[model samples]
Target chain A: MAWVTPVTNRNATARMTYLDMNRISGNISYLYNYAKDHGYDVQGDDVSQTTWTQNDIISYDFWYSMTGVLGEVREAAGLDKSVNYPATNYYSVNSLERYTLYTWMEITEPPEYGLLQNREGIQLQTESGADIEAGIL
Target chain B: MPTISEANKMQIRQPMDIMVTLQVGGDVSLTYSGYSDAKVADGRLDEPNKKMMPLTDLQGDGYPLNGSCKLYRPGYHPTSEEKWGERSNIGEPCSITITASESIGYVSAWVSGCESVTFSGNDYPVVNGTANIYVEDTTATFTFNPLYEDRRIEVSLLASGAYFIFNNDQIISCVVSLRSDLSLINPTLPESEIELQIYQDEDISERLASIPDETLITYSAGYSDEMSPIRNFYLSEKITWADNVMTIHAVDAVHKLDIQLPTASLLTDGSSDTGEATEESLLVFIRACLLYAGISIGIMPDYEDGASNSSLVFNRISLREAIAKATAWGRFGDYPTTWINYVDAGIPKLESDYSSAGWHIYEEDCGDVKRDAARKIKEIRMPVSALSFGDGGNYLTTNVGTGTWIYGSGAFLDFDDDVFAWSVITEQNAGIASVKSDETDYAGACERNALNFLAIKGLMEEGLPMGSMNTFYTQVMPWNSLQLATWNRYIGSSVREDQNLIIIGSKVLKDTHIQSFSTGEDDGEIITLDEAPIEGKLIVQHLNESAQTLYPNIAAQSILNMSNVTGSFKWKGDPRMQPRDSAYLHRVNGVTELITIENITITHEGGGTSAEITYRKGKC
Candidate 1:
C-alpha cells in the first residue's frame, strides 16, 4: 500500500534493500536512513513495513545480541570473554503460512539486491534471463 | 466413643416455652438414651430403651443434634408462689436514689402493700443479695445484668412463686420510679364536665316506661354455605346466647337511662305561609340533616331498602313529611303490631341490613290526623329565635325529665326560640325504629368508627376527650411498608439501633432486640404478654394480599416478611372498605412456606359492599 519516501528531492526513487537476513526485520526507518546517507531512493516492498517502522525496529533486536560476541574472535579481538551471544539453531525451520515470503538467491550469483552474503551459494537471475550483477545503481 | 454426664440426660418437657442448651465438648459418639422411669420390680431398674441407640432414625453424619421445636405440651405449669409463700404483707414503701445520669436527677420508687416504709441510697437501692423476711413472705433481691446496661435494674421478688404466678396467671404491681420534683401544676377538669351528648328527636324514657324489661324477638335466617366456619358459628347458633349476654352488659347495653327535654318541639298546622315549608320540604330537610350527621360521624340510619341489587340503603325522605309523619306516629300510634306496620318498619329483610335493623320503625298506625299533621310539621326550623329555642350552655337536654317540650311525638304549630328539635320516633316511625333495635347496632357502629380512625390516622383511642389518656393505653403499631422497611433497615444496620424499650405500665423491660444480648448478657426477666386481638391480624393479611395482587410479578415472600406496610384506606370511601384494625399476628414470625388466602368476609357499608380476605402462610 505504501512505500518509504525519500528524504531528499535529489533521489528520484527510494529503494529499500535487505542487505542480509536481518534486513527484512530492520524496518523502513533503517532503510530510509541508509537511503538518506547514500543519496538513494527509499523504497520498501510492503506498505506495513514502510508506514509504521518504529514497532518493527523495536521488535528486530536479535542483531544487537549477536554483534557483541563471537566464540574464538573474542580472544583474538581482545573482547570481553564473559560476553555471550545466544546460538541460533538453524536446523529448526519455521512452518510457512500464507503470508510468508520465501526469497533466496541461487549458486554463482554475486548477491541478491538486498542480501549481504549468500550462505546457500544460490545464483540470482531475472525472469528475462539477465544475470544478477553484484554492483547495480 | 465417650460417656456423657447423668445431668446431661434431662428430658425436654415443654419445648416451645423455653430455650434449651446442649454442650458436648469431647470427641464422642452421641446417642439418645430414650427416656424411662427408674423403678424396677426385682433388683432390675425398669428403664425404657436404656440400651443407647442412634440419636435419630434418619441416617446422617456430623448433623446438628441441638434444635428447637414448636410442638410443645401446653399444660406445663411452672412453680407457683402461693404454694411457695406461707404468708405475705405488701406495705406502702418509698425508696429514693440520686442519679448522676444527665436526664435523670432523682428517682423514687413507691412499693405499696399494706404498711408504709422508706429507704434511701445512691444511684440505686442497696438491696441486691439482701434477704428481707416479712411476716408472711420471704423476698430476695438480685442484680439483673441486661444486654444494655442502661436499662439494668436490681429486681427483688418472691422468686419461687414468681415463676408459677408469672406463667399461669397472676398480677404483679409494677413499681414505677417517680420524679419527686415533677408536680402537677393544673387541676384536671372534673369528670362531670365531660359529658357524652346524644341529640335525638324524642326522649326515650316515656317510650321505655311502657315497655317490658326483657323482650325476645327471634328469627331464623339461612346463610350461604360459603360463609366462614367461625362467622357461621357466631351468627347461626351463638347469636341467641350473645343477645342474652348483651342484655346483661351494663354501660354499653342500655344500663344508664337519663331523660330530658329540649325547649321546643315540632309543630304541624293545617297550612304554612311559605310554600317551601310544606310536608315534602320538611321531610327533605330531616333526611338531609340525618345524612349529614351519618356521613360526618360514621353512622348509617336504616330507612328503606335500596334497589334489589343495592347492598346498603340509607334513609332518604323529604324533610317535611318525615318529621310530620314521625311526630304524628309518635302521638297517636298504638302498641299493636300489623303487617303494613312491619313493611313500613324497615326491619332489613336482606342480609346487609340484618345487623343494623334495630333502628328501623317496627309498628305504627296512620289514622285520620296523619294528613293534617303532615301539612303543619314543615314550618319549624326557620332559625328565627321565636320559632325555636334551646337550653342554656351549662344545662344539656339529656334523656331525663319530660313536659318541657312536647317531644317523643305529636303534631305542633307552636314557635319557640329555645327548643332543640328532633323528629319524634315511635313504634309507628316507619323505616327507622325497627332497624335501630337490632342487638349488633351500637357495637357495629363503634367497631366501624374505631377501625376508620386507626386506619386513616395512626393514632388509636378516638371518641374521647384528649385528657382521658388513662382510659386507653396508646400502643402505636407501625403500619406502612416504608416505615417497616426503614425500621428493619435500622435493626440490621448496626448494633446501636437494635435497642428496644418495652415499657408496660411501670414495669419497663428495656434493652430488648439488641444483637449482642443473645450471649446470656441480657437481664433474666419475664414479661406477662397480652395476646393481640384478631381484627389487627385481618388488616395485616389484607395488606399482604393486596400487595401480592397489586404486584403479581414482584417477589412477595420477602415483602411479606417486612415489619410494617403502610397505605391509606380509612374514610376514603365506604367505611367498610377502609382498613382500621391491624392484626399483629399477620406480621410474619415463623418461616413462610407458602401463601394461601383463607376466611374471606364480604359485607356492606355506606351503600356499597366490601370484601376482605385473610391469608395464612403454611401448607394447608
Candidate 2:
C-alpha cells in the first residue's frame, strides 16, 4: 500500500497584487484637468478605485474600475466576478464578488483622444466582401 | 563733331545737368567747359520738366501695401513651440485673435483700426467665420468668448506675447478653420471636420523656425552662384583687380558655404554651369560687383560660339528695316555680323534675345519699347572652359612655383615644334568616368587638382567669412587636381561689385568669391575685420585688399572637414566640454566681428611682367 497524503504548496498559498494607484490616479487627473481647462466638465462623475474579492487570488491581477456617478452604481461596477474552478483533486473556492467597496474612491482620469479622432464608424471596413458571407458577423 | 568718347560723356552729363537744374528749380543751364576755355551759357537755362521718378518698391513711406490678406489655417500649440504666421509688433491698441468656432474653418486675422497693413505674397490668407485662435498677446481682451453648442475652444500663448509691427500697422490673422457655417445646425455631426488643436512640434519644423530671414538686397551677376540666397549665405567682402582669376568663397552663417563642385557634369547636377555665356551672364557678374557701387552696364552679346557674328553687319539696315530685322532674327546668334554692329544697335540685339527667351521686348501693336524697368540690367561672367579653352594634352596649365611659368604656349607640347596637336575635350563630363569603379581615378584626380588650383590661386587662405567657406571648399570640390586646364577653363570671373571686386564662380566647387582689391590711397592699410561680431569665434586678421581670408567658427570645422576643404584652420577649443574637439562651422554664436580671409596671389615669377590671360585667342 502506497502511503498517499495530499499537501498544498504553502509557498504558493497567496501573493498580494500591488495596485499602481499613483500612475492611474495621475493619468486620470491629467485628463480631468485638460478637460476642465478646455471648459468641458463631467463634474458629478467619480473616478473610483475598487478592490475586488479576487485581489489576492488571481495572478497578474489588479482591479480595473470604470467611472460613474453615485446614483448610477450599475454603470460603475457592472457584474464583476471571478469564476474559479478546480485545478486537480483539490476543492478550492475562487471567491467571486462585486462589493461596491470603493464606490466613493477618487481617481484621476487619463486624457482621451480629441474630438476629431474619437468617432466609431469613422474607421474603414477591412473588406466589405469576404469569401465567407455577406454580413459575416 | 564731338569724338565718340566726348559724345558719350556729354550724353551722360546732359541728363545729369538737367536733373540738377530741376532739383535747384526751373533755372537749369549747361556750363560747357570748351576745349580751351570755360564757356558759360547765360539765361539759356533749359526749363525743368520735373520728370517723374519711376515708381519702385522703395518709393513709399511704407512699402506700398503691395497687398494684404488674412491668414487661414490657424491652430493651438504648446507654449514653447513655434507657430507659422506673420510676426508683427503691436503698433497700436489693436486686438488680433485667431477665433475658432464650431461653424467655420480657420481664417487668418489682422484687425487694425487706423493703420496701414502690408501683406507678403498670396501666402497670407484671411477667411471669415471659423478660426482656432492661439493668441500671443498679453493685452488681448476676451470680452465675449464666442460660444455655441458642440463647440470647443483651445488657447495657448508664449510669455509676454507682443507683436512688433511698425507703429500703426496691426497684424492679425492665422490658421482660420474652413467654413463651418453652412447648413448643419450644431455643425459637430460631420466626421471629417477639420479642427485646430495643439500638437507636439516635430524636429524639422523646429529647425526651420530658427533661421531668421536675412534680407540681403543683392544684385545677381551673370551666372550667379544660385546656392547663395537660398541657403542664407551672402558675399560680404570681395576684392578684384585681375581678369583671369577670381577667388570665390561664400559662408552659410549657420554652416560653412563649403560646396564642392562635382568633377562630373555640373550642368545636369542642377548647378547652373551653362557651357555657353553671353552678355546676359557678363551683365549679371558686372552688376553683382557694381551693385553696391551703383555703376551700371548694358547687356552685351553672347560672343561664345560667335553669336555676335551675325549682328556685326546689320549697319546697312534702315531703322524700319532694323525693327523688321529684329522680328526676323530672334537671337543675335542668327545674325552673322553682330560683332561689327554699332553700339546704338546693342539695345535692339538684347531685345531680340529677350524675345527669343519668350519675353516680349517691343510691343509690335503699341510700337513701344516696353521698357519694363522692373527687369533691371545686370552683368555676369562665364568660365573660360565654358567658352573656348583649347583641346587635350595641349590644354592650358599653370606651373605655380617660384620659377617662370609658361602658359598658353605652343612650345610646351613639342608637336610640329610650333603648335600642339591634340583634341581637347573642354566639357567637364568628358573627363569623368560614367560608371562607378575602384578604377574611378578621375574623381580622385579632380579632388587633387582642385586643392592645387585653390592653393595656387590663394583661394583657401584663412580669415574669409563663414558664408563662402562651405560653398567653394565643400559643395564643389573637384576630384582631380592635375587637370589644371579643365580647372582653369572652368574658373571665370565677373564683376559682383562693379570695378571694385571680381565675382568668380568656381564650378569644381560652386563657390562665389569676390576678389578684394583697392585703388587710390587706402590700398595698403591692413583693415582689420574684427568688427562684425557673429558667433563667439573672433576672426582676427590683417591683410591687404588684394588678399583673401576664410574665417569659420571652430564649431563648423567638422562640417568643413567632412566636406574635405582642409585649408588653413585654427581652433580656440571649447571649455565646457573638455577632451572633445568641435568643428568651427557649428559655432553659431561664437563668431566675433567683420572678419576677412587674407591671401595674396602673385602671378608674376621673377621678371614681374604682367601677362594678359584671355578666354579664347581674340574673344576677351
Candidate 3:
C-alpha cells in the first residue's frame, strides 16, 4: 500500500477460480459417468456447490482412481484384488466395480499361492476352505 | 570277454517280426497288423489256448458306421492355447447309425445303436405306420422283426461292439466271451493264455475307426535262427471280449486232442494180444494209437528182449496209459518217457530215448566256446536230503516151479555193508493155483517181481544220495564246466562211485509189473491189487525152470542197479536240450562226466531269457 502500483489482480484471480471450477466439474462428470455406466447409485446433491467443494471433488477422484488402480494391478499380478480398505475414508466408486475388477484380474492371471506362503504369518483362506499362510520357509 | 558272435550264441534270440490275423467266422476274416504283445507257449503236456494276439484297434471295410449321432463323448485339450477357456461336448451320447451292407448283416446294424433309434430295413417290419422308433426313456420296445421265416436273426451286445447271428451259421460282427473257468491239466500245453484289454474309444474305435468287438484276431511269431523258425499260432475258436477286454484262448496240441477225443474213445479194442506181439509189433501198435489220435512219434527205443514174452490185455484203458504201461516192461525198459509238442514246428511227438549220443554241456571258462560275462554263474545247489531207500528193512521172496527165492539177512543192510546176504528155501505143492498149468507164465511172473525187489535193495544199500542240482548259467544250454563239477563232486566223493551213472530226462522209471499170475484159483485170472500179496505160498514142479527164472531176475537186477543215477540238473533253457539227449560236461575237477537232459523249460521275461534243465548225471 505504501508504494502501490496500478496492477490488475482480478484477472489472475478470476482465471484461477475458473480453472478450479473447471477441474471440479470435470472430476464430478467423470465420476458420474463412471457410476452410471457401472450400475452404481449416485448419492448427494449435484446442483449445490455448498455440499461438495472443488477440493473435495478432486480428493474423491484421486482416492477412487487410486483404489481402482490398486485392484487392477493386484488382478494383473495374479493376486486377489479384494484388499481391506479403510472404513472411515469416503470413495466415489461402488463395491461392485471393485469386485468386478478383482474378478477380471483373477481370471486373467492366476496367482501362485505357494510363493505367498509363510510358516508364521497371517492366515488366509484357500479355495478348498483350508487355512494357510505365506513365507512358510 | 566273448566275441560278438559267441555272445550272440549265448544270448537269447530276439523275436523281431510278429503278425496277427483275426477270423470272425468262416467268411468274415479280418487281419490286423501290429499288436501290443504276443506270446506263444510250447509245452510237453496238454495246454489250452496256445497263442495270444491283442489288437489295439479294429480296422476293416464298413466298420463303425458313417452317419454318427453323438457316438462319442467330448474330449478335453488342456494344453491348447486357443480353446483354453472354451468347453466342447462334440461326440457325446456315443450315437451312430449303421445301414445294412453286403458285408454288414441287418441284425448287426440294428444292434450297434446303443441309444434310442428308429429302424427301417428290408428284413425288419416297421411299427406305428412308419419305421420302428424306440423313444428315449420309454418302455416301448421293438423286437427284431425279420421278414423271412427261415432266416432268424439274433443280436448280442459285446464289450466293444454288437454281434449278429443269422441262418444258424452266418455270423455278422460277432465276438463271443470266453469261459471264465477253463480247465488246465495238460502239461504239454502253454503255462499261460493270452489276455488283451482295450478301452472303448481311446484304444479301439478312434485308432482303427471301427466298433470295439467287430474285428478278427490272429498272431504269428518267428526268429532269425534256424532253431526257432517262423510259425503261425492260430486257434479256430471264437474270441472273448468282456468289460472292454478281448482275450484269445490258445491251447497246446495235446489239449486240442483232449477236446476232440472223449475219454471213452481212447479205449483199446482188446483184439490184438500185446504179449504175443514182437517188439516191432508193439511199437507199431503204439504208433497206430498215436497216429489215430493225431500225434507223431519222435524216438522209440528197442523193447526189452526178456519182457517181450509178457502179454498185455487192454480193456477200457486209454491208449496213452497203455503206451506208458508197455514202455515200462522188459529187460531194457527203464527208458525215460516224454511227449514233446513243438509249437513252432506244429508237430507233437513222443520221445523215449535215454541214450548219451547227442547230450553234452561244456564249461564256460574252458574256452571251448565263447564265454559271456553276463552269463556268469553265481550259485550251484545240490540237495540230497530227500534221498531214501524204497522198502528198506523188508525181506523179499518169490517162488516158482517148486523153488522159493528169498533175499535179506532179516536185518536192514547197514550203509557200510559191501555184500548182500540172503537165504533160499524149497517149498512143495505151493503152486500158483490160478495158473497152475502154465509153468512158463508162473516162472516169468515170479522172476520179474524178485528182480525188482533185489534191484531196489541193491541201489539203496550204499545210501548214495538221490538229489537235484539247480545251477545258473549265462547261456541257454547247460553245456558248461560247472555241470561237470556237479557230476564229479557227487559221484567221486562217494565210496560206491563205480555205480553206472544213468541220465534220464524229467521222466523217472519206476518198478512196474509186467505180468501177474494168480494163485487163488479165481477163474485163472490175474489179480490186480494195489499192494503185492506177501502172505501167500507159490508152488512149482521143477527146479530147472526156477533156476532159469532166477537167472533172468539176477540179470534184471544188474541192469536196474546200473540205472540208479537219478536226479535233474536245472540251468538256463535251450530248445535243443530235448529229453533223453546226451551231453558231455567238463567238470571243474578235471573230469568230463557225460550227462543227459531230462526236462527243459525255457522262460522269457522282460527281455531276459533263462532255461531250467532237469538232467541226470551219466550216460544211459
TM-score winner: 3
lDDT digits (tens) for residues B1-620 of candidate 3:
33222333554444222223332322221111111111111111011122111111111111111111111112422121111111111111112222222243212222221233233322333321112232222122233333322211212211112222111111112121111100000112221122222223223323232323424343222232333321222343455545544444443233333322122111122223232232343455556656666565555544433322222122233444334333333323321232111221223334334443454454543222221121111221111122232222223232111221112111111111111221122222221111111112221222223322322222233332211101100001122343233333443333222222111111111233343322333333232223211111011111111101211222222223223344433333333333446677665566876664444444433333344554455543
Please, what is the TM-score per model?
A: 0.13, 0.17, 0.29
Over 4 Å off in model 3, which ranges? A1-137, B1-251, B256-277, B296-312, B331-346, B350-359, B363-572
Judge candidate 3 at residue B469 and give its lDDT. 9
| Runs with alpha carbons beyond 4 Å of true place in candidate 1 | A1-137, B1-250, B267-298, B301-352, B356-620
Which prediction has the highest lDDT against the true structure? 3
lDDT of each residue in B1-620, candidate 1, tens digit only: 11111111222111111111111111111111221121100111112112211111111111122221011111332122111101111111212112221232111111112122122211222221222221121211211122221111112221110010010011111110100100001101010000011112223333223323222121111122111111000011111112111111001101111111111112222222211122222333333433432312123332322121101011222222222222211101121110001000101111111122111110111011110111111111111000112221222322211111111221122111112221112122211100011112221211123322222222111111111111111122223443334333433333232222211111111121111101131333222112211110101111111211101111111122222212111111111111111222211233222322222233222222222333222211
- As a whole number from 0 to 100, the lDDT of residue B306 in candidate 1 is 17
B5-45 in candidate 2: lDDT tens per residue? 23223312111000000000111122211111101111111
Instruction: Quantify how close model 2 is to the true structure by its C-alpha RMSD in Å.
Output: 33.7
lDDT per residue (tens digit) for residues A11-99 in model 1 = 21212112222232232233233333444432332212322221111111333232221212223223232323211211110111000
